[model samples]
Target: MDIKPLLLASGMIAATALAGCSTVGGSVYTASYASITDAGYKLPAIPVSKVPEQYRRQIVSYETKEKPGTVIVDTTSKFLYFVMPEGKAMRYGIGVGKEGFEWSGTARVAMKREWPVWTPPAPMIRRRPELAVYRGGMQPGLQNPLGARALYLYKGGRDTGYRLHGTPEWWSIGKAMSSGCIRLLNQDIMDLYDRVEVGAKVIVK
Candidate 1:
């Protein structure tokens, strides 16, 4: 059986998604990421070929002392690992904060939300006055910075003002971007949102 047609179709899907010239449906990487509607918001397919394979979500033999249900963010490597039982982890590529904006600490998933509203922090607005227009909170939608899901972080019962959230900029994964949030692709974050519970331990390193 000739497989050239299958390979060519996969290539076209990636190209169309990358060029943003067409709606992308299933081809390759469909099991991991395909365009979908979540909470009435349509998320475009991610051209996962443009992202390194290691950054794609996969279950790996990750040895860690952290108990299951803990989230470990490896800042240097741009990876987020959700600890599972039996010395394994569900690892996903992530985008972290830039230079001075990097944060490292233990926190809890204080809250979880679907299609979360985004309000620029006061300090952020101070830096970019144009965002003052959103001081009242930006309504949730596809264009929202928080994307399809957000896991708010807190420590010692106080809001840490950081979040593990989804981002529309899937290309930014495996890189240092964002102000301080840990951002993942829409599909990855949606998977995480369902797996992670509020009060899950999060260690950012």
Candidate 2:
């Protein structure tokens, strides 16, 4: 089977939804085209009770300050820390950038979106023409590139366009992967999203 047609079909679905009349939808459809919604896509839920008991507390260690409400991600260790003030951190497993995209820096959460529209950067589209379907912003939905939720980053008040977000691909955790975003499991990100607000400090190193 030729992979090109398969990829092209996926691109068409993404492109069509993005180009469709922009309006909020009342019903949720699991079909790929039905992914986008009014507020944003509702990320699929995986009951925490069902999560493997063994995987619940997967810890990647680092000695960062435990300042209340601050979040830290150590790419080297694939750990995300939610500072808990009393010299302890609540850590979660994460997926970092694919080798060449790995970066270290400090930034702040400039904004947060429940489900964000995604527009491929010129380089990203150039690298994958299939992404050209989204020359305009992709609609917010399960199919959207930003995934379940997006925490936009900023440095000195400028949009960095990089995000810390969730992915449907749960297996990607702890692995290095393409692009400049940080990927978390949907369950983990939903937990983190509930705890963070705009203006939170984010340290990625």
lDDT score at residue 119, model 1, on the 0-100 scale: 98
Tens digits of per-residue lDDT for model 2 on 66-127?
46778888888787887764455556677888978888788899888877778888898899
- Please give, for residues 1-205, the per-residue lDDT of candidate 1 as tens digits: 9999999979978875654331123222233577898777789988877988778887777889999999999999999999999877788899999988999999999899999999999999999999999999999988899999999999999998999999999889988979999999988999999999898999999
* Residue pairs of candidate 2 with colliding backbone atoms: 98-177
Name the 10 consecutive residues with the lowest summed lDDT in model 2. Answer: 24-33
Q: Point out where model 2 deviates above 4 Å.
A: 1-63
Q: Positional deviation of 196 in candidate 1, in angstroms? A: 0.5
Overall lDDT per candidate, in order of appearance:
0.88, 0.70
Model 2 C-alpha RMSD to native: 15.8
Please state every model's RMSD to the true fold in angstroms. 6.6, 15.8
